[model samples]
Target: MSLQTDDLLSVQDVHVGFGEFTALDGAHLHIARGGITGMVGPNGAGKSTLFNVLGGQQAHQGGRVLFDGQDITHWSVHRRAQAGLTRTFQISREMGALTVLENLLLAAPQQPGEKLWHALLNTAAARQHEAQAMAQAQALLERVGLWRLAHERADSLSGGQKKLLELCRALMLKPRLVLLDEPAAGVNPVLVSEIADFIRSLQAEGMSFAIVEHNMDMIAALCDPVYVLAQGKVLTQGSFAQVSAHAQVVEAYLGGVA
Candidate 1:
């Protein structure tokens, strides 16, 4: 299917494999800018694999990935990130030894003036940039509701808090597009709602997101034009209500809902 003008990310006939196992078979999807899109399926349905490919974490065997109209099929993960793409893993990837503020600082893209030679020769400039980065980090921490715990070690936070920190770090990069593996997994109910609200707030701010989540309720709440994957490919896509009522989706979920 062709993507509309509002689409920010597109995947066409993409295929991914691991040794003898093929995880994605001609999978296709589209995510509009400034909105949320959910990918839902049963276990081992290639949801995570597709996320990796789109994020440039894994190479695809065929097809292409386009972001903001540029082909990024061959881009490395860091390169893609530099080009305004970012993602969070299903399991939080926060460094245990780093404080929350430190994590945010690390996520900030390094400035050319932060190099050793520039720091030694242009001390004033380096310090000025450092101050700016620090201010930005503080604001992000507050935005994600983690300012009070900014100095705490990342490992000390609860699962829900870690997820929040991850979100903060992703935003610290000022990403235009974010692929979230599972923002609500392992999070408490209160925190899940907070995360959902944060997502909506970001969407309001013009960020685009592609989320892989199993929580149907969360999908119904956050996603529009949801895509359902089965056997490594898109089985169907439509509004949440439409996909929920699809006979094929119902059969895919439970032999038969009847």
Candidate 2:
């Protein structure tokens, strides 16, 4: 599909391979600005590989990635983050030793204290910026219902809590778009609801997201324009009801009869 003027992220005819194995074959999708997009496919369908490609973790053999009208096919992971693209993994990336509040602080972009000279020579300005980051982090933690445990180490969080923390950290970056991998994978029903609610809140405030998930409930609840991938290529794209009723989509999940 061609990229539209309002698309926040787009992948055009992307390809990836490893020796005899081809993980992705000319896959393409567009994430509209300020909207949530869902990606669902079976295991080994190249979903994860596609996420890596967009997040700058894996290099595509061909095609290009455009974010906000800028070509970022060769951008590095941190560069992508700096340019308003950030992601959360299937596995949490929290710093176990750090307190929950500290983790959010670290994720905030461009802390002045990151430079040695600023830490020593510009203590006043560095503290001002840090105080602002701390305020923002606390606000996010409170919104996610984690301010109660702000002083606790990240490892102390349960699987669901860690997922929430990951979401909170991504917000600290003020990302224009976030690639979420299974936000409700192993989370309990209560926390799953919380995650979904949190996402809806963010979406209303103009945060765009592209999520990879297996939970149909979450997908149906949150996604508008969903992309269904089978055998590494998009099988169909539409609303949840439309794509779920597609013949190929059903056959992809439930093997077709001979």
Candidate 3:
């Protein structure tokens, strides 16, 4: 199928397998620019594997991936991130010992000080990059209501806070599309709402997202074109209300609960 003009990430007939197991079978999906695309399915429906494929962590044997009009199916994870694609995990991957601000600084793409020669010479560029990273980190922390904890060890934060930190780290790269595995998992109801609000705010600022989540509330409230996967393929794609009413989607994902 032809990718729409507004589509940012396009997965076309992608296939993945490991020995006898097929993780994805000709999966096709599109993430629209400046929109939040929701993905929902039951366990073993290949959601995480799909995320891995998009993040360049998994190698697919067939099909193509296009990002911003570029064929990037073979790109490395670092390359993808540099090309404006980044992701957050279901489980927070924050550095436990690092201070909150330090974590974000480490995520900044390029720091002159990271080079030994630049550090030895104490280059002005290094100082400037570091100063800029610090300012960005501070602003992000404040936006997430974590500025007061910027100096605290990342490990000391609550589960929800750690998720926020992970999201912020991904944002430090200034990515255009963020693949969120499950932003609401393990978060308190209040914090989940706050995180949803934060995501909506980011979307308003023109950041696109593809979210895999089981929290139907967040999916229904934040997503427009929701895709439901079953047996390693898209079972349906539509507004939450429409998909929830589909008999197959209800049976496959909600076990008739819907």
Candidate 4:
């Protein structure tokens, strides 16, 4: 397929292997600017591997990763984040000892997260940038209904709450595109909907997303031009309706699960 001018991220003929096992082989796809792109596949279909490649956590043996029309295949993880590309994991990475508010503050670009001790001591945490980060953190926590739990240790929150915290922390970077890995996996149905709403709102505000989720309900609701991967390659890509009707896609899943 030809690349579009509006494509924000593109993967070209990507290949990744370990020792003797091939995790990804010539994987390619594009995420449009300001779009919620969905990726769905069966277990071990290379979804997470692709995310790792995109997030700079996994290096591909061959391929070009273009972000915002620039080559980022050689960029480091921190460089990717600085360039407004960030990701969240299938598991929440919240610091168990950090307070909810502090978690967000720690993610701020200007804070460097090394001042958590000073923040807790209420010393040197009032610097101009720190104060601005605190304000930003408050707004994010409040928007996610975690403001009430700002002072509480992150581990005390529910699974759904932890997911929200993880997402809010990612937002602390004010990213242009976020790679969400299974945002609905461990979340309850209601909170899954809430998370979906939050993502949609962010997309409306011009943030793009590429989500790898098993939740068809969410994929149908939020994503367009959904890509299906199987055996380390893209099986097909189209709207949810189009792919759901694909026979190969159905066979690749647990009886239409994909």
Clashes of each: 0, 0, 0, 0
What's the lDDT for candidate 2?
0.91
Give each model's whole-structure lDDT: 0.88, 0.91, 0.93, 0.92
Q: 1-258 in candidate 1: lDDT tens per residue?
A: 776788899999999888989899999889988889999987788999999898888888999998888888999988888889999998999999999999988888766544777667877777887788799999878877889999999999999999989888888778999989889999888889989999999899989898889888889999998999987899999999999999989888774222
Tens-digit lDDT track of model 3 for 1-258? 998899999999999898999989999999999999999999888999999999999999999999999999999999999999999988888999999998999999885235767657878977777788899999999999999999999999999999899999999999999999999999999999999999999999999999999999999999979999987899999999999999999789665244
**Candidate 1 least-lDDT 10 residues:** 249-258
Q: Return the top candidate by lDDT.
A: 3
Q: For this target, which candidate reaches the highest TM-score against the unseen true structure?
A: 3
Clashing pairs in 3: none
lDDT of 4: 0.92
- How are the candidates ranked when ordered by lDDT, highest leading? 3, 4, 2, 1
Relative to the unseen true structure, what is the C-alpha lDDT of residue 44 in candidate 2, on a scale of 0 to 100?
78
Candidate 4's displacement at residue 27, Å, is 0.5
What is the alpha-carbon lDDT of model 1 when measured against the actual structure? Answer: 0.88
Task: Give per-model TM-scores.
Answer: 0.94, 0.95, 0.96, 0.92
Q: Model 3 lDDT vs. the true structure? A: 0.93
Please list the residue runs of candidate 1 whose C-alpha ends up more than 4 Å from where it truly belongs after superposition. 120-122, 255-258
lDDT pick, better of 1 and 2: 2
Clashes counted in candidate 3 amount to 0
Which residue pairs show collisions in model 1? none
**Clash pairs (backbone) in predicted model 2:** none
Q: What residue runs in model 3 are displaced by over 4 Å at the alpha carbon? A: 111-114, 254-258
